[model samples]
Target chain A: MRRLAPAVGPLLLGLALAAACHPAVAGLLGDGGANRPLSLTRLSDLALNHLTLAASGFAFVACLGLGLGLVVTRSRFAALRGGIDTLAAFAQAVPPVVVVALALPILGFGGPPTLLALAAYGIMPALRGTVGALESVSPEAREAARAVGLTPGQVLRQVELPLAASGLIETLRTAFVLAVAVTAVGALAGASTLGTPIVAGLQNQNVVAMFQGTAAAAALAFLGDALLLAAGGLARREAA
Target chain B: MRRRIILGLAGAAVVPTLLVLLPLMHFAPNRLLTGTAIDAPSILGAMLWPLGALAAIGPGLLAGSRGRLAAAIAALACLGAFALLLAGLGHGAAAWTAGQPPAARARLAAGAWIGASLLAAAVPLGARRVDPAAGGPIGALALAASVQGLWLAGRLDALSVVVEFRARRDELAAALLDHLALALGALALAALVTGALALWRRGRGLVDLTVSGLQVVPAVALLGGLVTAASALLSAAPALRTYGLSALGTVPALVGIAAYLLLPLWRGLQGALRAPDAASLDAARALGLTPRQILTGLRLPLGASVLLGGVRVAAVQALGLATLGALVGAGGLGTLVFDGMAQFAPDLILLGALPVIALSLAAERALSGLEAAARRHWPS
Candidate 1:
């Protein structure tokens, strides 16, 4: 934690400072001719939508990923892990926007397609993190817990989960950040997001709008990164 | 063993359940409108029996198989069953579209794609129960052979995706070339930049920081920022526009992609360079080998696999990210994807997406093979 502080401190500070200055940046860039600049309230609203979509999708992916990871790590389900790991790797190689575009046909446009894409794209990181974190828990510890006559469920809840907490938190953080990124791409699918301005501005050649949108989107990602980093820091400290 | 059997049985149940629950195909009068659905088991009369037989026998073999060879054979049977079901769908589509206009499309719908994908997934998942490595090779071979046979028999000619391909053959070729160029160009740029930086020991910290900072920004935001910056530059010196230094299109896309690729490439190179341990380096030094000779003779050979591993990741990511080039008017396959989104043409979107997926997978597999070969030869 101490070593991480030097790196984390400046990153957090820089992101926050950049994010804090967005309104001023927007003002400086000015509005493109005949196009209304996104007001602070509108930008906040879009950011909220972006976060909401990311959080909702992250929630679904977290549950699915954690469940799958737990199942595959069990002794009986070991054989299934290799196949799933391969599939997850393959899925991760596809770009998030392409996933959104592919889902658009099946789910139609708007929030549903965006949500589906977010879940699909985010699953790989979450699952890999969970499996890795769980696997990192020493076998000796699990054996000790079992030797104490703790049931499999009890061992998992009391022994494994506690040991895995920091790793799990880190996984969630990575997965959440990924969800945030995918939400920005979800703008192409007509989901109202920080990416909305970016896409609209691109079509209209509104440079100011584009800049503002890009800034806000970056701000959202940075904010998410900071919050998650703090949470991960707390987890690491608790574990220590 | 009981769990494996249960899993096999559950896998076998997926296709039949999906077939009943969802429509097998969607038929549109033209490309513009949402189509009516054709359900399998209801419309495909005699084809269902063979599919049913294969499904049952595939799972039975999985349950009965105690050896890796048997499990592999079971995987092959399951994949062949999936192929036969798809061929049946193609035949059904042909029958449905017999009297329709040229614009009419009869394509496999959500059910077929979802069901077939699940079934395909099941083959490996089931086969791997006996042996972890038993499934993939057999499944791929079976899939390729059946797809080829179906294509040669003209069984898949009526599929809307095939029809879409036929209609846009020339445009598809151009898009393919553009897509390849964008991805490969960005990869080459990243390789050169990272290679130079990796050798500059004094600038390592700053380079790492810059790469991480670039990664922190989302790809879209990075691309947008590049567009803004490039436009600013071009406007400041309009003379540069004549030299093809435009704000939008290929320039921003290429730069953004290369920026993202830097971190992976740099990390991989660092890992590879460090592959020779302290003892090995000390021994090489004691042997009176110069630093440059040590690098080429020991580090390069030993670290080849690690380097290739990194390149594999960056290359695959580049291919995927290049699709966004279309968004900036660079005119890659993503143009088809976005155009499909705007026009609500699913086949057009598939035409773009499937190729990108294939390209990424192919790069991944090819690089992995090379990495394995490196590890074999060097044993590091």
Candidate 2:
């Protein structure tokens, strides 16, 4: 409670902004259509689109990053090892616009490239966290597992991985939050994500629509972040 | 065994480089070098001497002990000056040929000459000792000046470069190769810096600080804010507005992308720094080793794996964000995506998206390799 006081201001401001930009309220009161009733179908459609896009991309990023992190951390090949780090750095340095532009000709517009972009962007945190967590595991515990007649695979699964699960979860949470935030930017590539309304709103100079889109994107990000944090906390508790 | 491992590791880096380049070459236009008989040859000819000079500085500065630091500083200064000179010369020539006033042209010419002269002079002084206190201020100034010069040069008909290349498939291929080369150069520089920093106390702090600053900001919001700020400033400033420089494009987008890419790198660094336990420190100390010996012999070696992890994070993040550079007309894959959007061409979009995805996958593999090497070399 005491530590959270510092975050209160930002939290309140965000909530207020979201409320002010609520699509239902804005559509009814703003200049575009005072008479037009707020439709649930439209809202649900937007929500579904957002969820699908987020889920597919976020899952890929999480899995890829996690697996890469584990393999790199444990692998024995010298060339493969050096190559991995360099590639990761290279991937990160390449701008998202460049990535999308390069991908456009191959993946086509709409969802595929957007998903690829999101996955690439989201992988770093999860990958890094996975590596960090696994490396942080106690050598004594590993030795104990070996002494207890556990094979390498069993030791990794039942002991090392379990111990590192909390950290991995935290990494996933962070990646999820980042993915949610970036999904809105997918509108630039013709994805019907939350950014579509925002871009359209901006172009049309429709403040209400802009607010609605921005609010929705921000709210979704916040909600996603909250859920991740909760998941991380639960994982940590379980680990403890 | 160590030599063999190193050799093998070196060989692996070539595969990804080739993969990225192959596609670029396949799609490259035919007339890339056409009409370059006069200007192109001259540019290439001029570059040879400067490139030679630039190449020599690295080895020269690292030779002696007393003046080593100074030599490095001098080399950097020379590079900075040369970069500025090139930029100023390009702009001055453009402005002069555009029929600018005599006084303005003379001023630009003088500035360019002075910059070039400074660069030429600094190159020979690679043996000079650097004053540690002066290094920070000088480096900051040099970076600022270089960036400003590049920005100016880049703005002067740089769009024509993109348009020209786009007009020809061979040219586009050549340009892609050039871009990849630049990217590789940057990676090599980063690796060198990281390796050097691993050997120095001050270097570690510098690396850590750089990473921390990058990690703190959210990418999208940061981009948005910077774009807004640039637009506001440009609108307010008559001079900038006259130049037709707007924030909605390359500058802000690049800044945003760069900032986003930096976050993972910084976070990784932060983690690496804190990775080692106090117990390890105490144990190393108890073995009767001095602080310097302990750091080099135990701490650093152990920390290498973690540090590389950070490097991996940073690299991947950079690759992904680099795609976004096209949003502001920075070129690369984002250009295809945006072009597709404007024209509503899915094929064009896929063309761009496929390469980026392939690039990402390739990079992911390379980083994984590095991580494994780090683990092996710096095992707990």
Candidate 3:
């Protein structure tokens, strides 16, 4: 109960804020549009789809980024570090929308292209985080673990990863937040995320649907951030 | 004597060589339909020598202090090859459409784009891996010279993007200017706001809350919120419209971009202001320097690089977010991108996107160089 206490604040704050905003339906807002009024069932369905896309994108990025970060940091592979940095810098320079647009031709309109773009855009943050977190592990800890006659793999698992857990969690938080935000841009590529209505509104000049979509997207992003914060809090407490 | 190969050079060259095996161009009968892939070998027949040369030199570059000159030469060779490859791609694009009507299109496919971007980016990395000091300036000069050469000869004119650009030349120029104005204008505003907040000192909590709160909002949503608020205000006070304040254009776009920029700018400002060592600050105090003198004479000088570091981040981010401005009719390069998307013309989209990517990368490189120069002067 003590460990879980810190998680409750953000979780409750997120929920309370979300609930407060829930009543500002399209009809109440009164900006005229032909689009359907945003109902609770429809809203939740959109939210779930958004979450699914973001989660899958995050998962793919985490695996590839973590693996690449690990491999490049190894002694024998140190020569590849400069190349990885250059590639990562290039990746960062290209905007997420551009990635989505470019992927549209190859992957066609829908979830797959959005997913690919999200994965591409998210890779840089995850890779940078893993590399930075692992590097932050004190050299002394590794040396001490080695002195205890532990194998290289054992030292990494028992010493380095344990020490780097907090930073890694922080990295995941950043990556997840990014995934959530970029997924909204996925609507441009025909993925039925929250940005769907915003794009639709823009096309039809439907101010109300755009406003509602914007509010819902913002709420969804905040909710994800809060959920991640709670999860980070729980992890820290467990580590302690 | 034992010879060790430079792995960076080897990897950089080999990857592009492998990518060449994939489709290098896409040929479509018209702008709106699916295209067929064209292989590199079919287009670049004799011109593939540059690529072959790069592959041959890849593993041959030596690793060691003695290999510095070799690395520099190799770097120049790699870039020169890259320039030639680009020219080949353009010419190939032209030839592939020679027999077809003007409505037919030939654009660089995924493989060529991926390979070209990778090679262009990797050459510097490979150079630095071997000889960090000798390669940067000379390589940059060579790249500039080659690009100028291509432009002078009009070799890249036949490429689909250049064709698109010729059609919308004036619009493209105006969009580029708008992009710069939006990004830089917002950057300046964020700096001022951050500077004011930093001076307030008591607003630390306010700054933290604002920064984190702003981050939670998706950028498009933020823009939408601003648009709604502005329009509502305009409706309530019709007189404000006389002052040229309206929703749906530069006003909301600037505010939204600046709103997102506050976090990075504020963090940078705080970090730079606090950069002076405690002992240095104490010494300045003991020497009877005023707070203003200490800040100007000590802190500002030392923290210049750190502040510039923050500006680089904010600038890159601003350039990217500016793309969303097109959604609100704030016309920029994204106009071309969204227009192309609506028409399903990949080449047209690339025409907008490629420039944006180039601008951000150029900004990052220039700012980083400034940061390094600042560090050298400050010695921190």
Docking quality (DockQ) of candidate 1: 0.61
Q: For model 1, what is the error of residue B230's alpha carbon versus the real structure, in angstroms, after optimal superposition?
A: 1.9
Q: List model 3 lDDT by residue over A66-139, tens digit each.
A: 88888776776676676677677778878889888888878889899888878877888888899999999999
Give the per-residue lDDT of model 2 (tens digit) for B147-254: 575765563332222223344456345435533433344344555544555557666667666654343333444454565568559868859966767777656655
In terms of docking quality, model 3 is medium
| Predicted complexes: DockQ each | 0.61, 0.12, 0.57
Q: Candidates' lDDT values, in order?
A: 0.81, 0.54, 0.78
Q: Give the C-alpha lDDT of model 3.
A: 0.78
User: How much native contact recovery, as a fraction, does model 2 achieve?
Assistant: 0.22
Candidate 1 ranges beyond 4 A from true positions: A1-22, A30-36, A140-159, B63-66, B121-138
Model 2's DockQ score: 0.12
Give fnat of each prediction, in order.
0.58, 0.22, 0.51
Tell me the tens digit of each residue's lDDT in model 3 across B133-174.
655655556667887898789888877777878888898899
User: Of all true interface contacts, what fraction is found in model 1?
Assistant: 0.58
The Cα error of candidate 3 at residue B249, in Å, is: 1.3
CA displacement after TM-score superposition, residue B329 of candidate 2 (Å): 4.4
